[model samples]
Target: MLHVLFFCLCLRQVNGEFVDDEVKSVMEGDSVTLNSGLTEVIDEDLALWRFGAENTLIAVINVIVGSVTVYDDVLDERFRDRLKLDHQTGSLTITNISTLHTGEYQLQTNSVRKSFSVSVYASLSTPKISRDCSSTSSSSSSCSLLCSAVNVGHVTLSWYKGNSLLSSISVSDLSISLSLPLEVEYQDKNTYSCVINNPIRNRTTHLNNTQLCPPCPECGHCCDVTEAVIRLVISALVGVATVVVLAYDIRPRKDE
Candidate 1:
């Protein structure tokens, strides 16, 4: 057993031109196809499809003898009932993809050789954002938001203040719902967004801090005192300046 393990490790060390690297991205529970680009097969031709860096034999198609074999005994459980071959093109289809299926796939024939790198991503559900009122404080009524999703894998959950990302978390193959929290003070006037994503797709929700967590106090809501005070002072100064300008113009009425 140790010798076989050592040989497999050693195999990972070799790289060669016979490897025709292709990239394929498929969502978890989905299907993907690897094509051989062969339009015809002859009696003397030999075609083989394999998986992994070790090139474990997967399927064989001998059109000359009119036979097809899916070497199930050599395949892992994930590929059982999931692999199909096209006799004409020699393309392979993998159904119900999962993280376990992510890896290298190889196709070999008498005349040509090729390879593929397949990546399986979990589908991320649309994120739901809800207000968390218990996070309120006396000095400032903060708007805390919770973003959540379910059944995600190999993906990231993140919070963004406009285009600038704030906080992010990642996991692989989580079949349950998870959430991330974001807090913004009432006076915060910037835009915030929450996102759940993988390399294939992203779902995002946007929030305007001023509208969602307005600065003014209402219904026993916490408000930022310093920010409200600053607003009041600015309003007062603008009023006083307007009165002074009117008085100056009115006092010159004698010249008119």
Candidate 2:
């Protein structure tokens, strides 16, 4: 009869109402700890941890049985060798985490039930700036440019003119490319920069107007010079050929 009462109490604790979920954000390759919020678990208490929408069991601690299990082998080994459980508090720590680990985590204990929403973001890559050569024209005074980043996700690619934001583009998919375009005068001396950022971190690349958006080449003068050089070479070759022909005819005709 006493054992049955203890089992009933355990069931009530396990089925307790869960509190509001807490949100957590972490960078990729960093460690995050999902605190169980329990100071110390009693010997008669049971602590359980689950992950994802499927409620897959990832960890469990039954102090009464003196057993602690971490199911890191499940989920296609994604959590393999990465899960750590604090036996005292029933907290879970995921080391060297990636975006694949972003999900919902639940912890149930005899004292309280808690939920956490973990979001793992990839590190921001530096934005690259290049001239839009296709948009270049001798008559156009403005220089068209593109700033891009590859294999980035959950980031905003933005163009900033000094302290003001000029334009921006955002993406949420994984391992995708992002590009933002800006046009500025070739002689403009204003500071410009391209930035790629997430909620936690950002990367910035400054623009070098003189180097990237130099004044358009003088195509007309270049073509004219090239044409003149070609004509001069052709004329010289023709004159040489005529002189050789005349010398051969004048000197060799008598011998024939």
Candidate 3:
């Protein structure tokens, strides 16, 4: 548990030789520059950036002589011709963000002698679902939910139903088309969400929800669980805020 907590902290880091995932509202086909603070790398120093979902580094962007060189680790053969890097500017660019491109990216760099690490997040293309989807007869068997991430030379996929983790598969990116069987009842009106997460970036998509209808007989119990989950989430947020506030309040002023 302590190790897991430490890993989570490492993933959520913001500054001081660290990169935080900023909640940016970006549209498609926009180029955004991710700066690694000029302070971290002085002028004339070499810097590099590598991106991946887990232990392996999928793509690399090398910087030298005020230029960048990109090397892509071809996990899927399809990405061989698709991925490109700007050697002149040290910018990593993907031609078109597809549903498969959403994953965590690891940025590793060096400043003269010392090495530093950072993370970048990419989001999945969220195709909106019609709000007027009024079909309770639709069962889970009609659709599928899948979340995927690259982990240590393999991609891990997990399927879920509401809060229950149903099935998972670990395979090479070339074999990532596996599917899981599901059966959603008409009463299961909950929106099924696929939260694909890695150390760098995380993407979430709502697969589907049986159309809203009259309350189920177990509506009261479901409501109780929903309320409980909400309270737990809120309490966790409040606790984190309290810790931050208290830590800042007690820190000595640098001017002193």
Candidate 4:
């Protein structure tokens, strides 16, 4: 009974040190390996792999019994057949991984115990840029523009002007959209770009001022021409009305 108590205390102490020693990020639909750092599993050694908050057993290797077991059928078969255990190193590899597999993974053996925090991120979409016509006011000299990304999560969306960051926003949720706004002078000729990035990859879309926010018609060009034409038509109608009034006054005075 004394020996049993001592063994239990030792086990608890070991478990207390099972904090996450490494963090890993992987893009969805890719494979990631959680290495055990073992050169070889000796004849008397036993290695075990567990996952998630429930600590469900997923894989086991016992060299003494000459057995290797993978409990992929458990946990609603979320893992299915995508688990691979290295015989020599006792490492575990997850193939064709998705967001559903994201969580903490624990590896335990006679000599070493470690934990890994894994984050799986979806592929980033290309950012889009458009003129915010509604936000543009006639009195404002700067053009209003918006950059957006849809169906993206765990990313940073930013606007850059000639390698300088103008604005940025980040999101931690899943499968959401983000939008950022920027104001630039309509006549300014400068390079601008929108970028969306995750830890593993990034996508960029360059801003096209000519296509999105073209220069307004010159002050003395189309607008001025339209105003001049309207004034000329109004003046001609007024002149014809004045001549008719004078002719009626001169002819009606003789009858009176």
Clashing pairs in 3: 68-87, 104-201, 140-184
lDDT of 3 by residue, 1-256 (tens): 0011112222343455544443222222333333333443334345555444443444444334444444543556424444555444434445433334444444445532221232223333332222222233355434322233332222344555677876655444444243333334445666665444333333455654544232444657888999999999999999999999988877766435
Clashes of 3: 3
- Residue-level lDDT of model 2, residues 1-256, one tens digit each, is 0010010011222345537567777888888887777778874378989999999999999898889999998999999999999988888999988889999898888667778888888877799998766575545777688899999988999999999999999987876788888888768889999999888788999998568575435655788899999999999999999999999889877887
Report residue 183 deviation for candidate 1 (angstroms): 1.8
lDDT of 3: 0.43
Query: TM-score for every candidate vs. truth?
Result: 0.64, 0.77, 0.31, 0.73
Over 4 Å off, model 3? 1-17, 23-46, 58-68, 111-256
Give the Å shift of residue 183 in candidate 4.
Answer: 1.9
State the TM-score for model 3. 0.31
lDDT of 4 by residue, 1-256 (tens): 0000010011323545644366777888788888787788884378999999999999999988888999999988989989999988899999888888999899988878878778888867789887775575554667778899999988999999999999999988875679999888767789999999987789999988676575444534877899999999999989999999999989999888
Report the alpha-carbon TM-score of model 2 versus the true structure: 0.77
Give the Cα lDDT of each candidate.
0.74, 0.82, 0.43, 0.82
Each candidate's number of clashing pairs is 0, 0, 3, 0
Model 3 residue 64 CA deviation in Å: 5.2
